[model samples]
Target chain A: MAYTVEGKGPSHIGIRMSNDAPPSHKEEARAQAEEALFGFWVFLMSDLIIFSMLFATYATMTHALAGGPGPKQLFDIHSAALETIALLLSSFTCGLATLYMRYDGSVKKTLLWFVVTLLLGAVFLSLELHDFIAMAAKGGVPSRSGWLSASWALIGTHGLHVTTGCIWLLIMFAQVAKFGLDPLVQTRFMRLALFWHFLDVVWIGIFSIVYLLGVIS
Target chain B: MSADPRRERRQELHGYIAGLCLALILSAIPFAAVMTGALPRAGIVWTIAIAALCQVMVHFRLFLHIDLSRSHRDDLQLILFSLLIVVLMVGGTLWVLGNQRAMMG
Candidate 1:
């Protein structure tokens, strides 16, 4: 009537002993485990909705370069190429992290994949910020040209999303450090993985529709 | 079961490759057309259309994860709904803003 796991060395590994405890305690834990994921999805949807408005604003002004250096002139496809490949690959890596979390149950493998996702994300953001700074050094401020303005609006907006996602990753990593891949943490990470990939998908849209097409002539 | 998810993903990466190729082909064709002066400036529509398709691939394969399955009905429905809203907003922006610009000129 009591229960225990095969090994109880780490608190991260646990088994219910509901034989003595009331059923409500078990039910409460189960509900908490599930709600984090749904709540995370809702937050992600809200984030995307904000991104949608930014998209509209940037799209409206993309064509309005004010005769200054325009998308075809200033936006470098090669740099964007590096950023794109890094991000797209990171997305795959992040998905891998979730798989490891869900199935592998090795905190080490999940950590390994997460580090990859983090590094690639870092590289992508650094490259992009470098692009922005390079533009700024050349006096390509947002006020100079509507196209450049929209470029900042669009790409910079995405840059913000990437930044926050990175922060979220760090938080999740911290939680894992605290709890390993416990069920509660696993569910939390599952949500992060979904949002992280969602960011990647949005970047693909920005790359092709906004960067690749709008920038490259 | 030590089925590495990366293995399956490796194959799926090909689909991303194909999507990129299609996007480039679509964009490059118009580029070649313009370079050769085969199409008028108004033929920019081709570029927009191809860009739209490229995004479609990203959504289906990467984000929403829709495939030929019964359970994916929810995903398909979500995508269709988003598509409708996207089309309305983007199409309306293009039309109204474009017309406003034309009128100003």
Candidate 2:
């Protein structure tokens, strides 16, 4: 029942366990882990800058409809809300996965939560794709208008990131299965959690500035 | 940060639940404002903006485990710096473009 996972072989892989190593070794490992996590945060902030630029572009193009359909005609609030919920739930489940991995050290519970998170992420992407299809059916294609182009660029970028995250989640699942809860695996999972949660943060901006404001304004 | 793992896990769980609840509420308000059409256009706009800002804060505080505590100072600084860049870039873009549109009109 000890949460500390000892390496199974003579390879000394377990020496880097973040929590259970001898005192000085534990401090060094924890410091390294924190440094790596901080580096990941910096990367997330850079990604934020990219999203902000896209947002600025979308904002400027809102009025350049070029006689094509506008947000009001193209956006369905119900579907957007559903997508928001799916993503939010996925983020919450991701948090749960981290909790299981770090706190309970229960591989079974951690994997279960991650599986749920992946499913929710999939649901969010499907709903987004459906929305795009619906918009195109209504002549809301990016080629039809500057506004549509900007909208597609902004929303499409976020969607692409989510797709990448889903793939990463699957790969992490495989790693977790193969490596168990090694510190390196845990560190990678932490980065993935940060990425996933950061995506939800960006979605806040998207739903608010893009979808909600688009329909309302 | 508590010494007890059980207590720490409980605290983290509470944080996540709180974040999710607040986010859901923040999201619902803007959507409701728009869907119900019960507010003035300006009011709906304000609601959406304010709710979004608050939700973003909630995500950082609760889900990301960021705060003004000394240990989190570095993260807070990084985030603030990023926010400054975003404001400069996004605000400048809007101002310049809006001026151009005004002149063309």
Candidate 3:
């Protein structure tokens, strides 16, 4: 079997030869990667649906402050801005890591970039936790009102995803150290890249719809 | 190492950098608009929401590499379909819940 690289992105398609021969190792690996990517894409889409529901719930409860502190009183633009930058930078670093893995195939360089990405992710999570704690201290906990509850649920769900993503990054680090850039390791890295980017996308929604609009309104 | 030529590899890396720059600019716009109050509150909200939508597309095309290019058509189709479902669910929820609140009042 013959393979042709046919794209400029992380998910490059491999064109298969028409000849009727048993699949070679390269062909099998490409097929497996493609299948894994497709499956992961499905998972990300389902995750998107879940986030949409959370946003919907948050929107409905935006005005249900129940005489408690509303968004304008609670959300600090500076902190939110800091959190946004951290996550966006992390997303960019994650992309760089994937590119290094695909183009240069340098495990050390990829791992370096992955570590940076992980650090940025950690910073984002820490800032988010601080924001939550500060809110809770001011009697802005989730149980305060429908508004606060929805706010916590929406932002908390995204934070939970970020936590899991950081754990996934740690696992990837271990895998890369042990297995190098084998096909399985490569496939896992690709999926994690997708997952990381998806979280950033969700954060975009949260910051724009939930925080920015909340402040404006 | 990829079989592609050195020039092609460099170009691919450039794509990622371009994406990063665009995403940063897009994110900064919304934040700036809100903080500076450069626009009215209503305008800022809409502008930020629209910018977020555009940034999502940028992430899809550049970061995740899901594009309209021939090789990635299937992934593109899946994304569009999923987007349709998201729109329906979000829009439906807002509509129903909003109407109920209005009636109750």
The fraction of reference interface contacts (C-alpha pairs within 8 A across chains A and B) present in each candidate is 0.09, 0.86, 0.73
**Candidate 2 CAPRI category:** high
Model 2: lDDT to the true structure? 0.88
Runs in model 2 deviating more than 4 A are: A1-19
User: Order of all candidates by DockQ, from best down to worst?
Assistant: 2, 3, 1
- What is the lDDT for A57 in model 2? 95
Best by lDDT: 2
Q: What are the per-residue Cα lDDT tens digits for candidate 1 across B1-105?
A: 114545655655555455455544544454454346565545654654565566556545644356656544544555566666666776787778878878994
i-RMSD values for every candidate model:
4.9, 0.7, 1.2
**On residues A1-217, what C-alpha lDDT tens digit does candidate 2 reach at each position?**
3333343221222222334666656555666677778889999999999999999999999899998999999999999999999999999999999998887778898899999999999999999999999999999998998899999999999999999999999999888777777777888888999999999999999999999989877
How far residue A210's Cα lies from its native spot in candidate 3, in Å, is 1.1
In model 1, which runs have C-alpha deviations exceeding 4 angstroms?
A1-39, B1-59, B62-64, B67-76
The stretch of ten residues in a row with the least summed lDDT in candidate 2 chain A is A8-17
lDDT of 1 by residue, A1-217 (tens): 1112233222222112112224554454444444444455556555666666667767777668777776665666668767866876777677667655654577898899989999999999999989888888777789998767777887887888789889988998888887667665666666677777777767766766675556434
Better-scoring candidate (TM-score), 1 or 3 = 3
lDDT of each: 0.65, 0.88, 0.83
Of models 2 and 3, which has the larger TM-score?
2
TM-score of each: 0.73, 0.94, 0.90
Model 2: native contacts recovered, as a fraction? 0.86
Best by TM-score: 2
Clash counts for all predictions: 0, 0, 0
